[model samples]
Target: MNPLLQASPLPLFDQIQPEHIEPALDTLLRQAEDALSTVTAAEFPATWQAIAAELDVATEKLGVAWGSVSHLNAVADTPELRAAYNTCLPKVTEFWTRLGADERLYAKYKAIAPESLNTEQRQAHKNALRNFVLGGADLQGAERERFAAIQEQMAALSQLFSEHTLDATDAFSYYATREELTGVPDDVVQGARNAAQAEGKEGYKLTLKMPCYLPVMQFAKSSALRGTLYRAYVTRASDQAEDTAKQFDNTDTMRSILTLRKEEAALLGYPNFGALSVVTKMADSPTAVIRFLRDLAAKARPYGQQDVADMRAFAAEHLGLTDPQAWDWPYIGEKLKEARYSFSEQEVKQYFTLPKVLAGLFKIVETLFDVEITPDTAPVWNPNVSFYRLERVGPQGR
Candidate 1:
């Protein structure tokens, strides 16, 4: 049996591979379709438990299996995995679009009278109805076809954007001498040195990855190094020929995403994408959400202004730096923190190693909750990945 189709308490991440993706998804999708057929049949039970146990259970398992593959593709991204994910993405999207637009399933749920159900079951039915409406359940002929096409296009565009962004980020590198790395953390310097040694290079190797870039901005004494990294980070997936490499450019992709989103919103009878987006969100409407954001900006404007002024003053007085640029902000901020708090970030970082941090986190959670959280060993795609099991503790010991 394929490990992807295994019946484990959790995902078999270690055993799952790019080759298993298509076969597993094909099997799962078929299973889900079969379950849907049974649930929408004439003789199927009208009760909530009957529908949920018979159909929802199988569908939920498929969702979980697919979710694990998606999650792995994001964090443990590789060329093979990316190809596999893209190949299966369209099939998954098409399956969902068809399932959502199924009037027969919607009719079955609608036929279940709410008065006969409990509070939870009744609320679940109501939610299901609302979702069905949003899923183009009532759309017919051309309109329904357009809606499904929009969904498929959106899925493909999203995957393309993600691939471009990741590829662009991974394509950059900045090798620097030891002297240029002044004020940077020892651990960061060590990490870069280790990377260079792996490639049998002379100087430390720096990449556009957050772990390497952040410390350089905050602590590297070389202004040129900081500027180089800043431009690379911001201009990723951009069409700037000089500042950026222009490879994996997503400028056109961004425009297409916005355009498609607006059309999708219009099809759904909403003013814009924002309005359609906030329907299932906490904000009641787009206008209210925009107002709330503007209010927050107003409240924080003074603090931001004060911080800028302080940084300007500190640069002029202490560092002999008159004009501070975008790249200088983090460096100046770090210096300001050290001066004001009587401590450096390097000093603070020494005590907060990963193991210690995890222990502290566990201690705090255990103190607050009635559940016991324990470290769990699992077969993971990445060595760094860790899992934990949370168990309920009653009066009697667990």
Candidate 2:
């Protein structure tokens, strides 16, 4: 049996596998298409309940199933799972595009009487009408088709860019000797040593993962090591990655994505992509956002410039580093903080172990909200992930 076909409140991550993705997606897509057909039929009742019961239930199921696959691809990606996700992504994208473009479905949503609905239904109806207009539901033949095509293409390109970035990040590993790791924190060094030992290699292994990369940049004594790792980190998904063969360049992908977004907005009668984005968001207008950002930047620029100058002066006078570059920023910050404040970030980090932090956080939340949260070992996609459940406690609660 396909585990994905089994209905549950949450995904059965314990049973889901890469092999199940394609079949599950195909079945769910078919079901969703059939549901839309029912909802859009000529004789279908133009009522919220009719639409919700027939179409919304099927759509939610499809979303949940597909969401599980995509989430797993992000958190626990292997070659097989990645392949399956990439293969199914287009089909999923196409289904949503087709549904959104179905003028009949949009009309069905429009045909419902707002006065007949409860508050929730009325709110949903208002949103549905606005979204239909935004979705180009009223557009003529060629334009509507183009709009759907843009959505499908953009979805594919966005997924590709993300995959390439992740693959590029996972492709490089830097091995460092004990001497090169001087001034690095004990925990970071131990983690790096463990990484190398995991592969039966000697010395420390560093990667672009934030936990290792950030610490090394801030504390490693070797300027060469910091500069090399920083360059590799920033140039990920570009041609400049250390693993040249696995560059996973996103330059073309990003260009295509931006072009498509602009075209999509123009097709919908919006001046630009930013204008289209703000339609569904809280922002009033693109110009408003731009002005706000500019004003905020103007206010912060003075303090920011002074910060840079202070750091540059300190680095020159105390560290014997007359010149500093992009890679030197974190190292300088760490040194400056210690010299000025007599405290190091590593010292702070050591006192707050992961378990201690989580326990303290849970205590704070429980006290503040009068609720409970506990670890739920209900099979997560990644072993490192922790799932928790929250529930209200009544006066007689145990």
Candidate 3:
């Protein structure tokens, strides 16, 4: 049996292979389609529980299974896993598009009386009705068809964007001599050396991964080395990248995504995507959101300008950098922080071990919420992940 088909509460991550994806999704999608048909039939009653029991249960299983696949693809990507995900992407997108825009299902949801529902159910029912409109259920003929096509295109483009960025980040590496590493933290330099040795290469291996990149920006004394890494970091998956790296450029992908989003918004009677987006959110309209942001910026702009001015003065007087470039800001900021607080970031980091931090956090939460939290076992994609269970503390201590 496919591990994805197992009736476990949590995913069997260790057992779920790329090969299991197609068969598992095929079965789950078929079940969800059948459930949709069952619920939307004219003979079916327009009640929440009845519709939920048949449709919701099936769809929830599909959601969990697909979510597991997506999570693995994000955290532990491989060529085989990526191929499977891309192959199944369109099918999943198509099913969701069709389900959301199904007029029959929309009608059934519309007929569900709000008064018949409890407080939570009524809120969910209200959200469902709004989502139906936003999902293009109100569109007819060519417009509806175009909306569905747009959704599939957007999903494909989004996945492609992520792939391009990931590939670009993984592709580039720079080896620096010990002298070039200069003031960079010892642990980071040692890790880079270990990485180079593992690959049988010379010098310290440096990549765009945050762990190596951030410390170099903060503490490295070699400005030229920092500039090299900074340029590569900013140019990843863009047309501005080096010629060899241009294959992963997202220039056309980004343009296509924007165009489709605009078309999608228009099809649903929204002036722009932002207007359409806020319909389900707390903000009243796009104008209101924009106004709020502008007001916030106006209030914060003075302090921001003062900070920039202070950084500039400090850089000129202390660091001898009269004209600081984009790459120099983080280094300058770190220096300024050390001078002001009389403590380096690395100094503070030594006291907060992961185990101690988590233990303290758990104690605080348990005290505040009157709950007991315990470590629990589950299959995880990697050893770094942990699972926990929470239980309410009863008066009898049961």
For candidate 2, write residues 1-398 as lDDT tens digits.
88788877778887889999999989999999999989899999999999999999999999999888888888888889999998998899888877776889988888898899999889888988888888778788899888888888998888888889888878879899999999999988999999999999999999999999999999997889999898888899986655573459988898999999999899989899999999998889999999999999999999999999999999999887789989999999999999999988877887999999999999999999889998776666667778898876669883
**Descending-TM-score candidate ranking:** 3, 1, 2
Q: Give the residue spans of candidate 2 off by over 4 A.
A: 242-246, 363-371, 392-398
Query: lDDT of all predictions, in order shown?
Result: 0.88, 0.89, 0.94
Could you give the candidate ranking by lDDT, starting with the highest? 3, 2, 1
Instruction: Tell me the RMSD of model 3 versus the true structure.
Output: 1.6
Q: Least lDDT summed over 10 consecutive residues: which range in candidate 2? A: 238-247
Better lDDT candidate (1, 3): 3
Best by lDDT: 3
Cα deviation of 337 in candidate 1 (Å)? 1.0
Two-way TM-score contest, 1 vs 2, winner? 1
lDDT of 3 by residue, 5-119 (tens): 9999899998989999989999999999999999999999999999999999999999999999999999999999999999899999999999998999999999998889999
Comparing 2 and 3 on lDDT, the stronger one: 3
For residue 58, model 3's alpha carbon misses the true position, in angstroms, by 0.3
Global lDDT for candidate 1? 0.88
**What is candidate 1's TM-score against the reference?**
0.96
TM-score of each: 0.96, 0.94, 0.96
The local lDDT score (0 to 100) that residue 18 gets in candidate 2 is: 90
